[model samples]
Target: MNDLLQHYEIAKKNANKYMRKGQLNAYVDALIEMNHYKKLMKAVIAN
Candidate 1:
């Protein structure tokens, strides 16, 4: 729970950082990771 939220925030920040740096690939990857955490969070809550 907390860990997932933390990782989600980290991934979001990393996505923003990569976007600002013009690293398209990295930003996309970070976004995917963020979404992954988001889904996991939702699943946890649902359970």
Candidate 2:
């Protein structure tokens, strides 16, 4: 759980940095991918 949160934090920071650099598309894509991964993890954990 702690490791997953750490990875999410890192990914959030990277996405924000990309957005600040005007890489909106990349940032959005990264965010979407992150959310998808989180959802999948939740589903797996619920099993």
Candidate 3:
């Protein structure tokens, strides 16, 4: 899961770079996905 989070972070960073090229939606999606991942990680750890 840590690895997944790292991958998501990298993807988010890449998406950020393209925000000027019409990737704002992608960036927002990445942010949402990252937040989902955080929630998932919390749930897993609680179990």
- What is candidate 1's CA lDDT for residue 25? 100
The sequence of per-residue lDDT tens digits that candidate 2 reaches over residues 1-47 is 56666667777888989999999998998798679768766876798
Candidate 1 per-residue C-alpha lDDT over 18-44 given as tens digits, one digit per residue, 9 for 90 to 100:
999999999999999999999999999
Candidate 3 clash pair list: none
lDDT of 3: 0.75
Model 1 segments more than 4 A misplaced: none
Local accuracy by lDDT, each model: 0.99, 0.79, 0.75
Q: Which ten residues in a row have the lowest lDDT in candidate 2?
A: 1-10
lDDT of 3 by residue, 24-47 (tens): 788788778777777877887898
Q: Give the number of the best model, judged by lDDT.
A: 1
The per-candidate count of clashes, in order, stands at 0, 0, 0
Ranked by lDDT, the better of candidates 1 and 2 is 1
Model 1 clashing residue pairs (backbone): none
